[model samples]
Target: MKEELGRTIQQLRKVQCYTQEQMADAVGVSVAAVSKWENGVSCPDVTMLPVLARYLDTDVNTLLSFHKKLSEAEAASLISELSDIFFDSGFEAAYAFLLEKIREYPGSDMLVLNGAMALSGAMALSSTLVMDGDQKAAERYEEEIERLYKKASESDDPAICSQARFMLASRYMGREDYDGAEALIDMLPDEQAYDKRQMQANLCLARNQLAAAGEIEERKLMLAANSLNMVFVTLIEIAVREGRLEDAQYLAEAADSTARALDMWEYTAQLPWFELYTHRKDRDNCLKTLGSMLASVTDGWNYTSSPLYRHMRKKEGEERFGPRMRESLLSAVEHDERYAFLRDSEEWNRIISAGGGTDRGAGQDET
Candidate 1:
């Protein structure tokens, strides 16, 4: 019986273009077990038989037939459908469905791992969705995220483990549990973690913001310079809000020098930096920057649909800079019809009616 079963397993595996190691990995079993099953030295237990059948895309009865009881084409179709569901809808939804299928065909590691992956994916998505600052939602997301992380960690697949760790770190960040976030991040492989140049720059900005918030004044000029050069526009907004005009100016200057050094003088970074200059009562610089930006608006550099740009143009017009600003405002109206919708929006009307002050009261910070 073992010899016959091994023969059957070998034939089915070959038909599916799977190596023993590949099949073993997919089914969460050992290559030795697959080898034993194929060599007729041993047959899998009754529990593992259903798992093997599912993994090889055949029924137990057909597998026991010793000869072809099912067509290879039919088995291929079933395998293709399973692969599609697993890849498309992701692991959780597919796993939920597979769990029901497992009940009908018990003790199948093929179903188990597939279901586990689906469950993991569902948990990851849930964590991401609930990542907003809701305590109850965060708790729920964290629970599921931890469960998936544990499961993935115990699995042989290093990729899945890495992904789970990344998601866990993200969840920790969402909950403002920076210690937990750091722990998880430190555990990740450098290649698997958020260590891209842009990401590192953003991280520096976040750390600087945290330092500023905490009033930890050690005067880290390098930190400020790196963050401002990478994420100057955001710093400019913060500066404007906090009435830190000098800091904003310094940051903008640093960003401008970096942009020029990188030969990106007409980059998107310049637009908001120009707005920052406008806030600093530098109308000449703002006008000059806007003029340069307009000239650089080729197919590659164009971003006419930006609402912020429209708002900036409106502000520039109100400042009575010149006809050039007026023409830009007119061009914005002509290009993006979405600006028309924005003008008619209730929020816009309320803002206009309140003279740009919120109903919550002026000088009331909602941070």
Candidate 2:
């Protein structure tokens, strides 16, 4: 509290262009006292708060408060920082860190929503605590996480409110609280008409912001394409499970073609075929699909190569893997027994030797 109060005082004084000496004189305190307050070495006496607030053109409440709002970029950055802390220092550290942030920005809807998400995700992974007989500690964390999400769900910002509610519903579902989940889900908008992205684009167009509107639509299109790809994969899995090999094959082909048409990464495009052929134990087709997949890995892929997504800027640190991805893939193939049949094959040897060797029709016997 002292540190937060100190920061508020320093920020307000700077905004008003007041020197420490000036603030000291106006508040009837020494320059050193004002400096100490700003540095968090000490705080103003209770009676001096009103005088300080008056000189700073703010009420005592405002003078003592932490910032209540965070810009979009600031919120994203802080969330990423919290994730790093969670990974590097462990859940307890990250939980405490988020608690401090929530205290510092009690009214920030973004902070509250994202902080809840971070803690909830970490808490899920910390289930070992419950198993280790620390049930009370885990329960406390769950209660706090739920409270934050509920608080965020009441925010005036519709996006934040909806997301918080969605997260709460998901948590309830995870715990088999079907009634709680259903109640929260019922509160959410279920139709396309309530989609904020399209609404934002429409508003932009109405304001004569054509370029902004186009960008929004393009991003939406990209996301929809990705979702469609996932649906195709899911359908293929279901078809295979139903013993409909022909249907599974057809869906796999459709998935592969859809990926190419949408300009998705070539490696991802070939994965459906790879999985289908591996399940069929079609050695030649498996080798062919694996060869194509490995070649794509060696060839470097990005959205810039896609005509559809070129205009969209990729987020920093978004790439899932780096320079060692190829090495890792090769190691996995060598270790996994599923690929044991392909180990001694000439095509496999060549493909492995050449790092997904040049286009080989060597295993193209599959009609």
Candidate 3:
């Protein structure tokens, strides 16, 4: 607690453009005392704490570095806002916004961890752009992200520490710092005694929160169904690659059947068949599959109708591309060189003119 308090004091002081000597004068303490407090070598006298906190423009709780702890939903909402700022305004704007929030909630471990994540993503995106000063901006963002990750890694919350360490390991790996990556990876647990979702549900049940437990189980079921669908798709891909077209067809059917049985998204059910038909250059089937894929996106499908996922609710900030996504899919098919064979086909034209495949397309007929 003393160490955390010291770090917070130093951070706030620096942020307010205060030197140790200046802080000492403002708080009526010696420069040496301020240095000790910042270094965690000693703490401020009890009476002087409020004075020091006032000087740093923060309250005692913030100064002690336990002012706030964001709930998961709050953190997710904040991250979503940051992402919108990064994409719409610019990386600089997003970075400034996150910095302001960090100053406001210096003791929020989730905020710090999520801010680092947002910065890391924006920095990576900027690095990929061939623009002036992008390299320098990426470097600056990287330094701040690393600092925040290191700070969060020291948190008492195991979840925050683990996420911070994993992100740090990823950063190291990106820079070819193999030894650093390996060390961080070694700190992570290889297995857990119980899955966190199930454990949480059990806890809810113990507390007689039956509805909450049911919701958790419903979410778990939805995730399991999604994962199973992906496994089937992956096996189909591998089968096709190994010249096992027959096996691939069988797997694709299985994947489609599984999606229907689980009440999965319409697009997901058609995905495997699209991949398979494209690989075999089956133009007729490809056009049909593409139409079904586009129809799903345009028609607005959700899991609410699914009996298996009835208790699960959509999370705030979940990605929804809307009509623009359908347009992009249609545009890709119309212009991409890989789809040249489908471009002039009568079926392709019909599908496009009808504004992407209708409900009569592939998955609809199959199910």
Candidate 4:
């Protein structure tokens, strides 16, 4: 087992284009030490096994030839690393490598599950890319996603099954198969210990899609509004992306009403008022409302310096439309010291700028 582990370690090192000297340097050992370990003349000390495993980007057991002896957490970590490689690297390479590993670790369910997850993630990524252009590739990705979801659903673990169900619903929704998606959602246990809000959101989205396909405009509007309010914060995002300002306004109003109905002032406070202001073109009113909202938001988190705030300020100064309003909003966000979490994220800047690297013009057409 030790010899096999040494061989595997050597193989992975070569695959990563690392020389014995380089590997030794990374693991804090001598070149002769690495050579001796690889040749099975000697093995790394127990304390160094973790460092070696980490450098090799494999599990310690895999490097120590004790695949069958790993704890559950170790096994899970191995699966996770394999999934990352499969998703981040080319499919052909990941597939070839997994096929080899499966032959060696045929009894390992963790290995099999990781392979499924890797395929699913890859398919989803490919589908998103192709859905923007190549119809055939998009369809292929959808098919592969379904296949992987089915494989995952066969697991007895509730958590795994719930994830599979969610992915299946998402894929079905992507294909506009609302009925099939809803059917999968219906199969989920009511008391299942999963992310209930997310499941509910998916169901709401499915219902909205179905309503949009129906004959009743009033019913469609109501369902769409209900769906939007149920997940208003996210719906605002979708509306903005689709350049559907009127839709955003409708959803925002609905969200406001829903929040009132449920007495969820805190949640309602998080809904972006600037969205409604943008649609209404009531710049002064928008600024006033934004001031209040920003104050409340800052009160909740404590104002801290954030990349988003800085970007917003810069864009506000540069852009002609709503520059003053944005600047005011930034001041509101910066007024308190509790909202420190925003500074932790580098993407905050991109988020505030709509990822377009430009100041948004105020009166541009929705498209």
**RMSD (CA, Å), each prediction:** 17.9, 11.9, 6.9, 18.0
lDDT, candidate 3, 253-289, per-residue tens: 8989998888888888998888787667778788888
Best by TM-score: 3
Provide TM-scores for the models: 0.31, 0.56, 0.62, 0.36
On residues 1-367, what C-alpha lDDT tens digit does candidate 1 reach at each position?
8776786687566545578989999888899988988888887888887888898787887678534332434433333444446446743445445434433332222333344444444433333334454557545544643554544444345665666677667767977999989997897876545534445445656877543332222123223434555577877879987998778777766777675454342534465565675566454454345444543432132222332122111211122222223333334423344345335445545544533323311111122
Q: How close is candidate 1 to the true structure, as a TM-score?
A: 0.31
How much lDDT does each candidate structure score? 0.52, 0.75, 0.78, 0.54
lDDT of 4 by residue, 1-367 (tens): 5566566676567544588989988888899988887787877888998887677676666666555633456556665555556446744455556645644453344554556666655543343345357777546545654654665565556766777887788778977999999999998877656754455546756787533233233333334544555577677768877889788777767677664454333324434455555444554444345444433433332111332122111221122213323333453333323333332344335434542122222211243
Please give, for residues 1-367, the per-residue lDDT of candidate 2 as tens digits. 7877887787566544578998888878899988889889998889988888788766777667835667878777787788778767877888888766655554467987888887776665564667689999989889888888887887778889899999999989978999999999999976665778989999999999877787787788878877887787777778877899889888888887788788877676777777777667777788887776666666666776566665576676455232234545565566567677777888778877777655633222356
Ranking by TM-score: 3, 2, 4, 1
Selected candidate, larger lDDT, 1 vs 2 = 2
User: What lDDT is reached at residue 365 by model 1?
Assistant: 11
| Candidate 3: residue 9 Cα off by (Å) | 4.7
Q: The CA-based lDDT of model 4 is what? A: 0.54
The model with the greater TM-score, 1 or 4, is: 4
Alpha-carbon runs more than 4 Å astray in model 1: 1-43, 51-164, 188-245, 256-367
